[model samples]
Each structure stands twice: as structure tokens, then as C-alpha cells.
Target: MYRKIFIDDENAAHRELSIYRKGHVNAIRLNDEGYFVYQSLPISAHNYAALFHYNSIDALNALPFISETKNGLDSWDEAYLPNTLLEKLIGILGDELDAHRETKPEEIMLGWQDSPEKISYWRVISPTEFCSFLESLMAFVKEAQTTGYDLEFIL
Candidate 1:
């Protein structure tokens, strides 16, 4: 579901647009020598901001998303592609999807637009929609695994 919110920040009145942050989860198929071969349409992390803790550094660091490293660097810190990550991702997405299915919780995205921005914007992710996203992500991960490809989360 789409939601709109009013903000009182006077600084953004005349600005055209200012998107602070963006994230994308994509499944990539690479050739030998690590050359890019293919990439799936990204599943944006914009709606799932809570999962990444938004701007709360402490809470964000605690997430497993930062623990999974590729070549000794945080996986989420860079576009590090680790082939084994999808298996873990499936379990996480599966559990989250199931939770939404069972409890039917309503989640809203809290972003800069919700505070003070030129545009009045926000999102109310309904249970069904969130579940759909989880399902799509799970399916995407499964397909990537089956194809022997790796996933990359660009945040």
C-alpha cells in the first residue's frame, strides 16, 4: 500500500529532489575471471528498511547482513559476491515471510521523505505485499542458487 505523510521541514521546499540512500539486492551470474555475465532485476531494500535498521548504526551492525563477509570484507559493506550467501538468505526470507503470513503485521517504511522533504512521501507495506516481496526474493534466491550464480546486496 502507498502512504503519504506531511512534513514541516522548510529547507526542502524549493529543492527538486534529494534521495539520501538507496539499496538493491540482485542475483548475478558471472563468467570465469569474475566478469559480469548477467544480473536479475533488483529487489529494492527501500521497503525493507527496518530489516537493515535504517540509520541506527548499532542495530545495523548487529544484523547478520554485516557478518557475512567475502574476502575478509563485510559483504554488505561492498558489492562482495559470495556464492553461499543465498542459502542463508532463503532461511531468513522464509522465516520472515512465514511470520507475515501467520501474524499479518502492517509495516510502514520510515524514510527522509517522512520527515522533511520537498515531496510528501512514505509507504505502508501491507502484510500481503510484504509477503509477496519475501516470496519474490526467496524465489529469486532459489533460482540464483539453481543456476550456480551468486547474489549481491548493494546498499
Candidate 2:
């Protein structure tokens, strides 16, 4: 399972991008014309949020679904963060960003995956790559605020 980040403008235009992941494998499908079609990128929104110091994955996952008009609802197009929340997030992320810059990827383990056979796999993202992503996320949030778009998390 994965989560995709997208920006929808006032005109309902959507620009989607894949979240960064370790050892990513593209999942493709075939259309009627035998043309290969790829869906949105598969990256866990919880994991992505964890990278930003939002370690309440269980809490986030347990949030109740709201109507489409309500902001911060899961599986809805209304995940916009209000100005106050955005400001708080920015403040929190600023410190995290600086810390990430000084930390190396090898020094941090994002998480692990366990298979049925008891195999364990650890995933990590390079500091440079994570910094780039953090920069992009900050830019996206700012742009969303300026353009009246919502910062949505599709889990």
C-alpha cells in the first residue's frame, strides 16, 4: 500500500508526484490497447509523516472520516490545513529540517518490514534525498497556502 501527494488547483487540475521510498518497485498495468499504465506512486503517507516528526501514525490512522467539505478527513479531497495549523507545522518542520541536514541516512533507520517467513527488511533514506524532499514539501505547503489549495494526505 502507498500514498500519493497531489495538488489540486481551483480549476480542479491535479498534479501528482510519488513520495520517496527505498527500493521502490513500479507497479504497472495493461489497458485495453495493451498499453502499459502506471498508477500513482506507492509510498506510505504514515511513513512520510513520520519523517517530518509526526510520529502519531496510530492516531492519524484512527481519525474518523469526515464529509468532503470537512478539512483533514481521510480519503476525501478536503485535507486542507488551516493557516494556524500550517504555521505550527512550518515551525516544527524548520527544526526537523535542520536536524536532518546534519544527520546522515545511514545513521537513521526509517523503519522495517517483516515478511511471513520472519525476514526483516530495514529502509532508510539518504540525508541529501530527505532534505530535498523536505524542501519540496515546504514549498508545496507554502504554494498551497498562497493558491488556496489544500495540503492533503491520502493514506
Off by over 4 Å in 1: 1-22, 29-37, 44-46, 53-81, 103-121
C-alpha lDDT (0 to 100) for residue 134 of candidate 2? 60
lDDT of 2 by residue, 1-155 (tens): 32222222222222122322312112222123553323222334333534534333223333332335554433323232443355555555566577667765553333333433332222444566666666666665565445443343444
Worst 10 residues of 1 by lDDT: 53-62
Residue-level lDDT tens digits of model 1 in 12-113: 542233422335566665345765645554434343443443222222233344323432222234454456666766776766766566544444434443
Each prediction's RMSD over C-alphas, in Å, is 7.2, 13.5
Q: Write down the TM-score for model 2.
A: 0.47
Q: Each model's C-alpha lDDT?
A: 0.51, 0.41
Flag regions of model 2 displaced more than 4 Å: 1-80, 107-116
In model 1, how large is the Cα lDDT of residue 20? 26
TM for every model, in the order presented, reads 0.57, 0.47
